[model samples]
Target chain A: MRTLTVELGERSYPIYIGQGLLQNIASFFEKHQITKKSPLFIITDTHVAPHYLNDVETNLHKAGYTVISAVVESGEQSKSLAVYEQMMTKAIEAGLDRSSTVIALGGGVVGDLAGFVAATYMRGVRFVQIPTTILAHDSSVGGKVAVNHPLAKNMIGVFHQPVMVLYDTSTLQTLPIREVRAGLAEMVKHGLIWDEAFARWCDQHAEDLLALDPETLAYGLEKGCSIKAQIVSRDERENDLRAILNLGHTLGHAIEATAGYGEFLHGEAISIGMAGAALLAVQLGADPSLYTETKRILERFGLPTVMPKHLDTDQVMNAMMHDKKFKEGNMVYIVPKAIGQVYIDTNMKVSAVRNMVERLKEGDIHV
Target chain B: MRTLTVELGERSYPIYIGQGLLQNIASFFEKHQITKKSPLFIITDTHVAPHYLNDVETNLHKAGYTVISAVVESGEQSKSLAVYEQMMTKAIEAGLDRSSTVIALGGGVVGDLAGFVAATYMRGVRFVQIPTTILAHDSSVGGKVAVNHPLAKNMIGVFHQPVMVLYDTSTLQTLPIREVRAGLAEMVKHGLIWDEAFARWCDQHAEDLLALDPETLAYGLEKGCSIKAQIVSRDERENDLRAILNLGHTLGHAIEATAGYGEFLHGEAISIGMAGAALLAVQLGADPSLYTETKRILERFGLPTVMPKHLDTDQVMNAMMHDKKFKEGNMVYIVPKAIGQVYIDTNMKVSAVRNMVERLKEGDIHV
Candidate 1:
């Protein structure tokens, strides 16, 4: 097993990355000192519950922890106030208290929803993340947790770090190929934002990663989590360095919201958004190769490099207007300066972002 | 204005207490470094809007600030997820961005609801608390913001402090006498837990406070806020010392929930709970004078010292089981150890609490 810690001073926590760690989950609970006397609330989606809920519940029960499970529908739609309220109902009915731990047992959607619940339940409680998707390698590492607003993405949320994250790479084998391909988008984002060699490593290992090769997947995930942890440790609240993590997210969130969430996976939207950022970098006098290489690597992972042409550019721009990055007539964007590094642009013009979104829909943003 | 700072290290903020400070609201905004570039979203309830909304908006407008306001129904019911979702929708529609400030321009209900919106909106924005009621002098200082779950009070919440709290004592004149009496519950509570002199002062000046005597109210409010700020500085998330502030909240929340939110003002329920705590303390071998004095003071303020006989003790107990203070077969209660001091009883038996509840309902909890 390989472990990396997100160094948040007193709030710091560890990310455990390995194969088949779920089989030995009980010992990890003891190691982490998560109290067994309080009722445990496990939040998983329908997609993940059928596969792992029984094992997780039985193991905790065997460890003498009272267990209650809430299974939400599996999608971005599940990240709504209605579902969130229902989950709270289940938790209250099951008697979750201040000391109880809320465990996210699915992918990014479950992690975000469950984390938000933990962040607010009893004015904050301990949270545990068990990432069952490759995409969560990046999300589960950061303390940012949120739910989508009908008019915007991730509009309601808070920064609540988890006590620990357990990633069993064996779970990757159960993912559909499409989700696996989409998940690589965030893995690549970690590289695009800070690590040049890791970006190249991802490019070289694309075939192995796509085939669910456990060793390759585990290594890539650990590296992605490390880069994310390093960034979050430096800027826990996205005031400065952490904004770099949102490289593709500004435009990416708009695209995902425009597609009504499920139509385009978050990673796929981010993939296109990253291509746009790379293109904007070239427009700002970055070497045109920056745009070409980002596109090439994304395509190699089978992520869509173009936004859907049918979606209105104006609608996407309107969605961007509601994003956290959009300030007074400008966007606070993380634009690529190079393959391995990025810089934040506090005054990216609205007209320029509109043009970039227009070009992305047309698939003509190539350098 | 007398200012008390809740010294929370980097997150510390001031509570400004005085008469008619709302007239100079714009200057406080400038003094506090609240930005004017982004649209400001002010959340006030219907009860407060007709009285002060236009003045607040016009004052900001005169200062070159753009402002929007949402008026919710006035009462505890407004602190529901449904209402919370509506407020978020309004804030989003009003174009509130990352740098925009959300102002809670009402009492504790609005503060908790709006503070919650600010805490979660865009994963949090700047928040300001403009308190208009005596109850808020206590709540506005600490950053415990939340919306009540259907099953229990404050079942969903997070501790996100405000940048500053503005208390305008002149607004107290508009409060109904019942509310004024109820508000005294917290003021007296501060004395009960931390300052014996303040508690006796509240008892002595109950008539003046009930009549909206501005000088007495302001001095009392400042003292109360100072106590709250001091305690919050020591324990921000209720770990040890801070739980003392919840002196009557455990049973108070249960009785309030049993009555349904609007049937009893929060302070009224807390008054009965505080009396019950005094009774419990005497039952545990404290001087009988403690119980007599607690009841005498509560009655002088016109606060209900006995729980409603109609309320089912079992129903209140069940509601309490869903509270944050509930643990495995016991409760973590903030019991009155003596006048001006309190202690947390982490292993208080369930049966003893049940007996106390029965006695409270019967008006026979004399030591």
Candidate 2:
């Protein structure tokens, strides 16, 4: 197993990446001292459980670990307050306590929802993340666990780090084509924002990475998680350096909210957001070549590089105005200066953003 | 104002205790660097808004602050998931941003509900606690913000500290007799668990404390807050010393849940929990005199020293078993050995608890 540690002082934990580490999940728990006399609660979803839950239960039971499971329906809807309330109910009914552990075994939705349940259950509890999707490579690493509000995405949550993130890449073998493509967007983002060499490497091996070559995918996951871990360590609460992680998130979140969630995957929306942000950067006097390169690389990975046709500038603008990044009426954008470099710009003119959105809405950017 | 710093490193904040500080709320905000150009969202309740909301808003406005108000109903019902969702919607509608401040201007319910809203709104925002009740002296000092779940009290929440706790003692004068008595339960708990001198002082001055004598109440508030702050500083997440703060809360929460939230005041429920805890301690070979003294002091303050008639031993036991503090089928009780000293006993036998409850239910202890 290739392990990368997110150094967060006492709150630090490791991200384990390999093809079939789920079979050895017991040792990870043992090494992390997560052993409890009480039965550990396995929080998964309907879809994931049908594939891996019984295998995990058998492995854990073989290790003499009693498990209580809270399985919800498989989707973003499970991340609601109502579902969260149900998770709590199931957990308590299963008799999980402070001494008990919670293992979140699913994709981003399960990770975010279960991590949040751990964060607030009796103030807090110990939990491990066993991410089953490529998108979870991003969500499971950071301690930002939240559920969506009807009004906003990830509108409610906390920064509760997991004891460990066991990323069994074998699970990715079953991920749908669309999900794999979605995950690559964030991986590409990590490289673009922090490592030019890594970004170039990803560009060279795009096909292999997309085809799920275990070694190539593992290398990319490590690079992405390492960068995220470093950023989160320095600013766990996103005070300054951490805000860079939101490079495309400002406009990205706006698109998702406007289009309505599930219409576009998180990373898919973020791909389009990265394009808008690059344009914003060029307008702010950054090199235009970087925008071209970013769009090229995103397109190579089968991610969208242009705004959706139906989403008008007005809808996008209205959503952007309410974004969490927009503080005190100022739109904050994490603009890319060049590959491997980005800076936060708070002085973006609304008219310029409007102009870019209007052009993108009318397919004028290509012209 | 008498200020006590909570000393939580970067998360450290001050507890300002005095009369008439609400009129100078702007100074407190400035001093804590919670200055925001955006309008402050003042979250108050119907009961508290009439008396102090206008005064606080007018003063803030006079000091060149813009304000938005969200008035919730006055009670535990306001600490629901539905209410939390509404709070989020209202804050968003009010255009609260990362730069905006949330001022919780009521008692514990307001502090918990609003503080939680601040904890999760846009990830988080700076919040100040303008406590209008004596019970808030405990809730506001510690950063344990939460909204209650239908299944449990305070089952969902986070440890988000406020920039400052502006405890305006002047608001206590308007407190009803029942509310005043309720608030004293927590104050007496702080004394009983940590300081013998404070406990003795409380015992001697129970009448004065209940009458809302400004000097005595202020002294008690400062002492109670200091002890809580010290404990919270050492263990912010209740890993160890902090769990002691849950002294009577295990059964206290259980009682509240069993009786229905609003049926029994929080402090009233805790009052009985404290009595039960003392009895359990005596049974466990602690000083019998301690239990007698503890029950006598609680009686002097007009706090309940017996279980409510409607709640039988079975109901209390069932609730306690599901308490967040229970671990591995073992009920964990923070048992007081004497005034000013307590130890966590996690190996209590269920039958012993059952026996104690049976005796208490039959009024056999007094006989």
Candidate 3:
């Protein structure tokens, strides 16, 4: 078992990663002092519920913990105001109180939605993040839980950290092939933005990660979570340095919103956006190798490197304008300077970004 | 203007209490470094918009600020998921970004709804509280912003503090007589929970307060805001000392929810809950004067001292069970030991509290 703490003083919590942790979930709850008095609420999606819900429920019940679970649909569309309210209804009906804990037991969609519910339920409650998909290796660690607005992704949320994060690698064994490919987008992002060596390691270990090789996958999850935990610890509220994590998110979220969510997974949209960032970096006088290096990595993972031609550049720009990162008339674009490093260019012009996004939409090629 | 700071270190903000401050809102905006480049979104309800919205907008515009306004229907019903979604729609439509400011320009309902929108819009933005009702003296000071669920009040929200609280007493003159009375309930509660002399002052000056006597009301607002600021500074998240601030809110919220939200104003419902708490205190072997004295003062302000006879005890009990306060089959009741002091009782029985609530409904002998 490997453990990483997010170090948010008084609000800090541990992330436990290993095999079969879900089967021993009761012991983790006890170790963390999550109260057994108030009924526990487990929020999972349809895909995850079918596989692990019974194991978790039976184990918790045997250990004298009262468990209540609600399962939603299995995609980004479920991260909406309607679903959020539905989750709140289930929580209130289940008699969950301040002491009750909400456990997120699926991929990124489930983790974000459940974490958001835990953040605002009764003005905040205890939350446990149990990521079942590789993509959640990033989302699950940051404590940036939110529901998407119709116009934008993650438009409504709070910086609500979890009491603990329990990641069982056993769950990753069940991920679909495409989900596995899409999930590696963020693991690759951690390297692109901060660690050059890890970027190289990902390039070398791409086949193993895709095959769900236990040792390789676990090491990647640890490295990804550790980088995220370190960044979130320094700037929990994203006032300064944390914005670097949004390297590909600006255009990535725009692509998702314009494509009408669920057409492409979150990591897939982000993969395209990261590709756009690299191109924009080259246009902004950064080395062309930066763009080549980023695209190479994303493609090696079988992720999308180009935004589809059908999605209009103007519509995507409009979506970017509505994002939290866009302030005043300027887009807070994150530009990659090297494969392992990025910088926040707070004054990126709309025209410059538009020209780069247009290049991606038009499939301007460089190998 | 009289000022009191909420003393939360970097999150600290000032509460400005006086007349005509709204007319000079641009100066306050500049004083607090509310940017002029990003547009400002002011959320007001129908009741407040007619009298003050144009004045605030015109002044801000004249001072070179881009102002956008959204007027919601008045009262507690506006604090719902539907209304919250609508407000977010307006925010996005108006092109509000992370650097933009959200000004809540009404009473508690507007403060809560707008503050909530500000708290989560693009994962939060700068917020200013421009309170226009007496009830806001309490709600505006604390950063507890939320929209209510069908089953519970403030069941969905966060602790997002504002850049400043700008309270212009001039707006209070337009408040309906009932709102004046309802607003005094919290002011009286601040006294009941922390300061004895303030309680006596409220009792002695009830007539003056009801008449909106400037000197009396101003003194009371300053005192109420000061006590609230101190308590919030000590415990921002309601982990321990902050729960004391919910002295009457446990039953207060249940009464509000069971009555279907708009039927009773927040302060009025809390008024009846305060009366019930006094009755419960006496039942728990505290002095009978605590009940008599508390009831007498609430009545003097024309606040409801008894729950309606028609509202079923079982339904109210069920609603209380859904509250953030009730937990582990126990009611976390706040009992008054005297007119001035209170202690949190963590282990009170649900059945025992059901009896007290039944007493409130049956209108048992008192006074």
Candidate 4:
């Protein structure tokens, strides 16, 4: 297994990535001097529990740990206050304590919701991320866990890092094609912000990745995690460099909100959002040629490149206004200056963004 | 105004403690370089709203801030998932953004719930504490915000620090006598863990404090905040030294849980819990004389020296088992090593705790 450390001083932890990492989770517990009997609370979504919960439970039990699991519903809706309540109740009923460790098993939704639970439950507790989806490659590493409010996505959450992340790529074999595409969007995002070579590599091996070729998938995951690790280490709280990671996320989050959560997968929204961002970059005189190339590569991966027909431009603008990147009523868009560089622009006018939204609605962009 | 820094590195913020701190809140905003038109969400509980809501609103309006207020019901029950949902909705409707600031304007419950709202809103946002109750002197300054679940007190929350704390002591003038006594329990605890002089001062002037004398009250508030601030600076996440702040809270939280929240104020239960810890300390051979003196002093302040008669020992024990401090199936007790020092004992047997409960029932210790 290869280990990547997310350094945040004392709050730092390692992300272990490789095949069959789940088999040796007990070793991780042992290394941390945490035992199987250390009051383990496993949080998984309904989608994941049916597939991997028993294996995890069996392994934990064999390692001499008492295990209790809380399974939330599967989907974006699961990341709500209602589910957070259910999970906390289940955890309390199962007797989780300060020394107890929570293992979040599933995709981004499960990881984010469960991580928030661990961050708040009993003030805080040790948490482990056993990500079962490709999207979690980003969510699991960053320690930014949160649930969504009905009014906003991820409106309620915390930046509580996991003690360890057991990213067993073997688990991804079970993911649906759509999920794989979602994960690829983030991998592309990593390259767009920091590494041109990795982005080119993804473009070359997109087919290999789609086919679930182990080597190609592993390479992508590792490179994406490494780039994220470096950025998080310098700006753990997203004060500067970290905001670049939100390349497609600003408009992407707005799309997700306007289209209604679960209508478009997070990565799908981001794929289209990236297109919008790239187009906006060109509008601001940042080389429209590079934007076209980026859009072509994203579409080749089967990622969406257009806005959903039903979403209102005005509503989308309102949603963007609520984005965390907005400063003093001004929307701060993280637009790319080039393929391997981006900048946060607080001076961007809403009129420009609205115009772009109108163009998106008119099918000015290609998928 | 007296300014004290929480010293939590990047998360560090200033606590402005004095009469009329609320009137000049715009200056604090200016110091942080926050704008007057910044979207600010003011969170308060029913009990505190009628007293200070209009004034706080007027101040924010006069300072040109686009302010909105969300008022939850008073009491521990208000710290539930339902209330959090309502608050978030209100915040979203009022256009609270990532750069927007949430001002928690009430006692501990409001501070915890509002702080948590800010922590999770849009992944996180800036929050300021405008604590009106004396009990909040401890809760507001330390960034230890949480909302209690039905099964556990503060079982759901986060350690989200505020950007600023506006502690207007004048608001405490109208506080009920019971609340004054309750808030003193924490002041006494601060002294027990760090400063013996402060403890002795509380003991000697317990009556003056109970009467809400401005000088004594202000001294206790400042001392408590300073001690907590020092500990928080060294251990913001409560990994080590900060655990000392929870000296009486291990059992204190259990009492609040078993006694059915809101039946006894947090401090009142903590007062009883401190007596339990003192008894345990004596039994463990950690200077029995100190236990007698501590109990006498607590009684002089009109704090409870025993658990309420209606509470069952077994029920309390069961609740204690669910405490977050429990490690490896063993509960870690913070027993006093002396009047001004304490040690965490993980080896303490459950049987010993049970025996102490029996002793209390038989009137073996003064109530």
Candidate 5:
């Protein structure tokens, strides 16, 4: 097992990356002093519940922890306020209290939803993130937890850190190939924004990383979480440095929302977004070679390199305007200056972004 | 204007108490440097929108703020997650962003729902509390904002303090008499938990305060807020001292939920809850005089001295058992020790609580 700690003052917690760690959750609970005296609410989705819920319940039960499970539908729609309220009701019916802890036992949707429930339930409670997707390597580390609104993505939420994150790489074995391909985009993002050497390492090992090789996948996840933890620790509320973590997310979120949620997996949209960001970065005087490298690596992972044809450029622009990153009607782009380096460009004109989208549509953004 | 700061480190904010402060909101904005470049979303309910929303919008517009209004129906039902989601949609449609601010312009329900929206919007934004109800004197200051869950009250929410609470005493003059009577219970609670003298003052001036005597009402509200702010500063997450603020709220919330939200104004249910707590406190070896004084003061304020006949004792107990305060199958009661002192009793048996509830229903308890 490899351990990395996200240092967020008193809110800091550890991320444990390994294979088959789910079987050993009993010891983790004991070490953390989460006792059976206080109940445990295991929040999962239908997709994950059938496969791994019993495994977790068995382990926790063996550790003398009384556990209750709250399962929602397995998709982005489960992150709505209606589902959030329902989950709270179930947790209460399960007799959860301030002392009781919540464990999120699925992919990013479950983590985001359950994490949010823990964040607001009783004004915050302790929760653990057992992220089952590579995408969650990014979501699980930072304390940012939210649910989407029908009009916008992640519009209602708060920053609540988890007590710990137990990443069992073995869970990757059951993911569909398409999901694996999508989730890897966030790992690529971690590299593009902060670590040139790690970006190179990811490119070289892309095949092995995608194959779910335990050691390689675990190493990549640990590195991704480490970068995320460092960034979050410094800029917990995204005043400055934290915004860099949002490198591809600005355009990515807009594309995802425009394509309609679930039309493009978050990472798939982000992969395309990173390409657009690269184009924007090139306009900001970045070395054109960086754009080439980012696109090449993303394509090698089978992620989208351009915006979907069905999505309207004008609609994408409108969605971008609603992004939390927009300030004073100006869209702030996190453009890459080089591999592993990005800068915020708030002075960019809307005409220019529209032109970039037009170029993307025409397959003309290539340097 | 009298200003009291809820010192929560970087999250600290001021509470301004005076008459007609709403008219001088432009100056307050200028002093606080809440620039007009950022948009403002004034969230008000139908009841308050008709009375004061225009005044606030006009003041903000005069200060150069580009203002937008999102109005919901007035009452407790508007505090549902459904309403919360709808409010987020409206705020987004209004083009609110990181620089934008939300102003809650109504009673406790509006303050709570709007405050929660501010707390979670874009992971939080600046919001000022323009409380227009006497009950808001308590809700506005502590920043305990939330909506209701069908299963429980305040089941889905968080603690996000406001940037400022601007209490315009003049707004109280427009409140219906029943509401004014109901709201005073929180002030009485503030006095009971931390300030014996304030309790006496509230009892002596009950008539004048109920009559909207600005001097008496403002004085009581300010003192109540000072005590609450101090308690909140010391324990932001309710580890210990902050739980004392839940005085009368355990049974109170259960009673409220049991009767159905909007059936009893919060203060009315809390009045009955305080009576129950007083009885429990006496059984726990408190001075019997504490119960006598509690009943007398509640009577002076016209607050309910017994549970509503329609509410079932069994249902209220079941609701209390699910309270966030319960731990390991034990309900922790914040029983009053005296006029200004209270202690947490986690070992209290349900039979004892049931006995107290029966006494409350039968109107047989006496000092």
Candidate 6:
């Protein structure tokens, strides 16, 4: 196993990445000084429980943990106030304490929801992310954990970093094809924001990654997590540098909210949001050629290039206004300067965004 | 206005305490470089809104802010998942951005609920506390903001500090007598935990403070906030020194949860919790005389000596397990070392707690 430390001083923790990390749960807990006597709460979703919950439970039991499980429904809906409350009730019922470590074992939805539960449960507790899907590579690394409010997606949450993350790439073999495609979008995003070489690598190895080649997948996950770790360390609370990580997310969040969650996966929404952002960048005088190339690469990964046809342009504009990135009542879109560079631009106006949405609604782009 | 800084480095903010601090809201905004166009959301509750909302709103408006207000029902009940969600929706509707600041203008309940709203809303935002009640002298200074779950009080929340705290002591004159007594308990608590001189001062002048004499009241508020600021600065997240602030809260929270919320003011519950903690300390070989003095002083202030008769010991014990301070399924109680020193003792077992509860139930020695 290779360990990467997310340097947050006392709040710092390790991300153990490799095969069979799950089988060595005892040592992982020992290293963190988390023992069986510690109130250990495992959070998994409905879909994940049937697949891997027993293995996790048995391993934890063997390690002498007084383990309890909180299984939430599997969907975007689970990232709501109701589900959050249920998880808290479960933790309370199961006797979770401050020293109790919560193990979140599932995909992006489970990771975000469970991480958020740990963040707010009894004013925060230590949590470990045992990500079971390809998409969790992004969610598990960043300290950003939130649940979606009905009015807005991810409107409620906290930046609670995990104590440890065991990203066993072997788990990705169970992920559906669409899920793999969604996960690749974030890999592409990591490249677009900071690393051109990684982007080029994705361009060359997208098929290999889709085919579940552990070596290529592990390489992508490490590079993505490393880039995210460096950014989060400098700006854990997203004061400045961390905002860059939300390159496509400003518009991506709006698309997710407008389309209604679960209609488009988070990565899929980001894919289309990146397209909108790229076009907006071109309109605002960024190089047109780089924008074109970025869109081309996203399309090659089987990600959506256009907004959902049924979404109302005005509603999407209203949704963008609710984005956390919106500053001074104006939307701040992070646009690309080139394939490997992005910048936050707050000068974008409502009318300009409206016009862009109108163009997309009119089907002016290729599918 | 007397300005005191809670020195938490970059997270540090000034607490402006005195009469008519509300009039200087514009100046505070200027010093913070906050502009009127920033998405500003003011969170208040029913009890406080009728008195101070207009003045706060007018000042913020004059300062050129696009101000929006979110009001919840006034009480401990407001600090729950249901109300938190409603406030989040209001923030979303008002277009609150990450750059937006949430101004919490009420007592501890409102401060905690609103501060938590800021903490989780968009994964955290700038929040300012404009405390109108005396109880806030303690709550506002510490960066501890949280909402209670059904099974546990403060069972769901985060440790997000405010950008500034505007403590307008003039607003306390409108408070009820019971509320005044409740607020004084925390001041007494601060003295007991860190300053014996202040504790003696409180003991001597308890009647003057109860009468709301401005000189005595202001001095108490200032000294209490200073001591709290010192502790919080050294331990913002309650990892060590900050836990001292929760001196009576372990059992206090359990009693509050068991009795059902809104039945007793936080200080009242804490008053009982302190008594229970003192008894436990004496049993564990700390100074028994110190425990007697604590009980005497609390009784002198008209705080409840006995746990409310209706609460079940088992239920309270269950609630204790949910406290954020509980480590390894064992409750960690903050016990007094002497008149002014507090030490965390985590070695106590549940059977000892049960025996103590049994004694309290049997009317053993006036709590």
Best by DockQ: 3
Give the root-mean-square deviation of each candidate in angstroms: 1.4, 1.8, 1.6, 2.5, 1.6, 2.4
- lDDT (tens digit, per residue) of candidate 3 on A1-367: 9988889999898989999899899999999897878899999999999999999999999999999999999999999999999999999888988889999999889988998999898788889998999999999887899999998889898877888899999999999989999899999999989899999999999999999999999999999999888898999988889999998999999989998998888889999999999999898888888888788889999999888999998999999988889877677999998988999998998899999988886565662
The per-candidate count of clashes, in order, stands at 0, 0, 0, 4, 0, 1
Candidate 2 lDDT for residue A48: 94
Native-to-model Cα distance after best TM-score fit, residue B353 in candidate 1, in Å: 2.2
lDDT of 1 by residue, A1-367 (tens): 9999999999999999998899989899899998888889999999999999999899889988899999999999999988889889898888888889999999999999999999999888889999999998988988889988899988999999999999998888999999999899999999998999999999999999999898899899999999999999999988888888988888889888887889999999999999999888888789999999999999999998887898888889889888877765467888998889999999988888887777777666556
- How would the docking of model 4 be graded? medium
Query: Candidate 1, clashing residue pairs?
Result: none
Q: In model 5, which regions exceed 4 Å deviation? A: A363-366, B364-367
Candidate 6 per-residue lDDT over residues A1-367, each given as its tens digit = 6778888888898888898788887778888888667678888988888888888889878878788998888878888888878888888877787768888899888888888988888788888999988778788987789898877788888888898999988778888888889889998999999998999999999889889898888888888888888888898877777888887787788888887787888889888888877877777777777657877898888998777778878788878877778777666778888887898776778787777666655435532
Q: Which digits, one per residue and each the tens of the lDDT, describe model 1 over residues B1-367?
A: 7888889999999888888898999999999888889988999998899999999899988998899999999999999999999999998888888889999999999999999999999898989999888998888988999999889988888988999998888888898888888888999999999999999898889899888888898999999999988998888988888888888888899988988899999999999999988878887788988888988998999889887988998898888788887766568887887789889998887788888777776665546
Q: Give the DockQ ranking, best first.
A: 3, 6, 1, 5, 4, 2
Docking class of 3: medium
**DockQ, in order, for the candidates?**
0.78, 0.69, 0.79, 0.70, 0.77, 0.78
The C-alpha stretches of model 4 lying farther than 4 A from their native spots are A286-288, A363-367, B1-3, B10-12, B285-291, B362-367
Q: Supply fnat for every model shown.
A: 0.78, 0.66, 0.76, 0.86, 0.77, 0.95
Give the chain B TM-score achieved by candidate 4.
0.96
Off by over 4 Å in 2: A362-367, B362-364
Task: Using lDDT as the measure, name the better of candidate 3 and candidate 5.
Answer: 3
Better of 1 and 3 by DockQ: 3
CA lDDT scores, all candidates in order: 0.89, 0.85, 0.90, 0.84, 0.87, 0.83
Best of the two (1, 5) by DockQ:
1
> Residue-wise lDDT of candidate 5 within A1-367, one digit each (tens)?
9999999888889999888999999898888888678889999988888889998999889878899998889888888878887888888888888888889998898999998999998788889999988888989988888898877788888999999999998888899888899899999899999999988888899999889888889889999999988989999988888998888888889988887778889899889889888887776577888778889999889998877777888899999888888887777888888888888887778887887676666554657
Candidate 2 iRMSD, 1 decimal: 1.4
Arranged by lDDT with the best first, the candidates are 3, 1, 5, 2, 4, 6
Q: What would the per-residue lDDT of candidate 4 be over residues A153-237, giving only the tens digit for each residue?
A: 7777778888888899999999999999999999999998899899899999999999989988988998999999999999987
Across B1-367, the per-residue lDDT of candidate 4 in tens digits comes to: 6788989888889888888777777778778877665688988988899988998788768878888898888888888878888988888777777778888889899999998888888778888888888778889877777778877778777788998888888899888888888888888998888888888988989888888787778778888899989989998877777877777787788888987888889988888778888888777676767768778888887888776667788888888887777767877888888777888787679988877666655444643
| Candidate 1 segments exceeding 4 Å error | A363-366, B363-367
In model 6, the fraction of reference contacts reproduced equals: 0.95
